[model samples]
Target: MINVRSREFAVPFLQRLIQVDTCNPPGNEHKLSVLLQDVLRETGIASSIKSVEQGRSNLEAVITGPGSRKLMFCGHLDTVSPWTTAAGRYPPHGAVIEGNRMYGRGTSDMKSGLAAMLLAAASLHQDGIRLAGDLIFLATAGEEVDSCGARLYADQSSLAVLDGIVIGEPTGSRVAVGHKGALWLRISLFGRSAHGSMPQLGLNAVEGMMEVISLLHRHALEWQEHDPVLGSSSLSVNKITGGVQTNVVPDHCTIDVDIRTVPPLQHGPLRREIEARLQEIQQLHPDYRYQVEQLLDRGVVYTDPAQRLITTALEIAARQGGAGDAILQVQGVPYYTDGSVLHDNGRLPVLIYGPGDHRLAHQPDEWVDIDDYLASIDFYRELAIRFLGTAEE
Candidate 1:
């Protein structure tokens, strides 16, 4: 088995993972999957890779212990678009150790999280030491896109028996309890088209679109009620496209809106309210016609801090010098992840914690701190021991 005790094994493992260009858009993660499989095999852990699409894969390695409770540790293998400049997103190619930091793309975002977990599984030194529970290490794909790989895993009947899930997202060493839900809406405005010369003879589709947009702007302002932790629900028009030519009155215009919802902000009601507002605007402009289509809908994820997993995390954090207090509070994030799908469908206790600065995510100079990555490893390892205990296995 790969030794987790020394920094030697982890350094090389992480460096190799970074070297593999698994940047998404075509996210070919099979290369990394194969490497992980090889590591698991050497460590005497049986593993497998599952995928919805070829090359776009998820890796799962199970450490069977002597307990009934099963816990899963998940991390994503894909990175965002590479840096525009030749400098590289993950930085100086493989792992570059300078002082206290190991610079790289997926370091903070998650490759480091995955590496640490892998090392933990490979390095547990107790010869007869068995865990109080089963540990499942899963490196899922498409977390940066549609969460397709996570959905696939959640749907597996085997996952139903698990006690809970711990998602290794970059939370700067804090235990993130919850995140907001998301919905993508596309609104199309329809109107009559005629020659620009005879402006009075044609209904202006652009005007209809402008009115709808204005109404939404006002409506969004009305939703500014903030939650102490989740902050506030938000709506923004991200895309708008319409007219064909300057001379012709456009027949159609379409605008895409992104909405983030928190608890107390139900999706169905939110949608109904939006439609009502659109109808009100249409009433003032008789010639305007519009339709709203939902491109994607994901429910919000909320868990009780009293759950065993959350409690264990808090206790462990405390033992690690008050690092656990962050686990007690819920926070809102602008983006969505597989956590949403898993929490909603699995009905299992879920928490997000990891290393890396979120500001660097998907950016050109994206990189994670070396210290944060190592800290997350220790945090999760302690969290596991607290819950499973040393005696059971």
Candidate 2:
């Protein structure tokens, strides 16, 4: 394995990673996975790549020692398309560094985190550092969309023995302990199509959707489940499609609703209530009918703030990120992460920490500050020494 002892490797590693277009619509993460496998091999870190689909792949490399519990470092490889951005319009894959920032799609949304994790593993091995437990490095595909890559790796029995998981998602390099879950639903409302010129001959599907949209708001208030860390649970109409032509009253309308949920809000009950509300709306409008379908439903997930892993990360980041004696604070984000899948399904304590700004995740000019990325390496190195160090027992 090629040992990556310095932070300088992060810039080049991330640049190469960004240059690979693993855009989610056609998620060709297998190419990036193959490339990382080759790069990690220089450090003698052998990896196994598993295909989630023909084109999607997840990779894992294990640095082992004495303990039974494992510490897993995970990052997803897929990213949203940035082809429309001005820079991306010319070359979406070029990793351009100007001053302190490196601009490219997925630079912040997590190629930087993946590079950090890979380098941390390689550096630890090169330093002859051995923990009592195993240090598992994972880079998964399809995180920007379906999260299929995470779910695929989480299914392995090898992961079930994990002590904790570190997801190097962009969090401004601060530690984030928890995040809200998401529920996506689609409602199809049916109406009679008639001539647009006809005054009362047709039921407008778009008009029906206005009622459906209104009812969704009222229904959301019924649950009223709120989480202190993640704040209030809320739902919104994200996508609406109705009407075919200007001269015709559309016969059908569809609305996609996105719900950000906190704890104590059961997906089953929330879904049931939504269907019941749609039924109520249908009954109210005898001329129209509707069907509600679940597009995606995942409940909330949170790692305890007091977990040893959490404390260790905070301490390492504080000292290495120049906080000195000050304690680094942890906050919750409103977005979901691969950590949620690892925590919820694999039953592991997971921490969301890494370089770059979360606000820049999918933006056109997304980039990670070189200085921030460098500081993050020191933090990750320390975190490994402390958390993985316990394996010496």
Candidate 3:
């Protein structure tokens, strides 16, 4: 049996995981999934890997208990592409250790959290602890670009038995009760092409898109609703492109909009509102033809602070000692996780807690503190044992 709690076992495991390059444009997560499966097999745990795409996959390993209740520990296996310029000091997959931090592409953004959860489950099995409920470890793919693996699993799997979910996202070892939703949209406007000099001959799509942009800016500002934990909703037009060249009057214009939503804001209604705005534009300019495509939609995920899952986690953290009183408080992250999909429309109580600084996610030289990484394994292990309870209890 491996001493999963020891730094020798935990740190090297994370380093090996980070060494697997699962960057999201290609998102070759199958490699990491295979590695995890081998580790689980060595630990005497059975695991299965499912392919989400040609190169991406998800891994699942469960430790069966005596009862029907189930708890899941979920984390993503993909990371954003590393900086290609000289700005990056460490090799993205080197998993280099300096002092107390492990530097790599996915180290802080989450390979550490995934490693901690896997090791925690291994530790429980090694110690011969039997709980009243099942413990599940899930590693997903494509969270950085789109939650393809999570969405696939949520759509195909039966979530009826799950009592709670813990998302191992980078939360600096603090407990996060929820996170904002993401609504990504691609709006394209089409018009007739004409010579640049004779602009009057063509219906200018770029000019029409400018009007749409103004409307979106005003519409975003009109939202006043706010949640105490999640704060206010936000909208940003992150990317826009139009025209083939300076000489041609381009017939097409496209803009990508990212909207982060909190509670009391349903994505369906928001999408309808935008469509209505487009209709109003069409009413004014009959030639203003446009199409709106939903690129991605992830619902807001919030579990009540009073939920047993959360309270128990807080109690365990308080006992473990680290962030002090602040760790006990309920908080929310701006970024969405697999929980957004796995929450089953808020049916499952989800807890977002993990090692490393979220601020470092996606940044160059991303690293996770070694101490926090090890402590997270302890936290997850203890939380599982306490929340699931022993068969005797």
User: Model 2: per-residue lDDT, tens digit, 1-393?
Assistant: 333645466678878999999999789999999999998887778899999999889998998878776788889989998757544533567888888888888888888888888888888777777877888888988887778988887676456678898888888888888888888889998999999999379999899899889888988898767777677899989899989899999989999999998878878888888888888877888889888888876657687879999999887777765775333877777778887677756357778888888898777778889888877776777787788775455
> Model 3, range 73-184, lDDT digits (tens) per residue?
9999999998665978899999999999999999988999999999999988888888889999999999888889998989889887799999999998988999988999
Instruction: In model 3, state the lDDT of residue 279.
Output: 94
Cα distance off (Å), candidate 3, residue 10:
1.1
Candidate 2 Cα RMSD (Å): 2.2
- Could you tell which candidate, 1 or 3, scores higher by TM-score? 3
Task: Please count the clashing residue pairs in each candidate, in the order shown.
Answer: 3, 9, 0
Best by the TM-score measure: 3
Using lDDT as the yardstick, the better of models 1 and 2 is 2
Looking at candidate 1, what is the lDDT of residue 302?
A: 64
Per-candidate TM-score against the hidden true structure? 0.87, 0.94, 0.96
Sliding window of 10 residues with minimal summed lDDT for model 3: 320-329
By lDDT, highest first, what's the ranking?
Answer: 3, 2, 1
Residue range 1-393, candidate 1, lDDT tens digits: 434535666677787888887888778888888899998787767899987698888899877767688888888888776665465544634556666666666766678777877766665532445677788888888777777788888787465687878877776666566777888899999999999999788888887798888888898888745666555788889999999899999889999998888777878888899999888877888688989999778877666778888877766666665554554454545556677776646388887767676666666545566656665667777767666676543
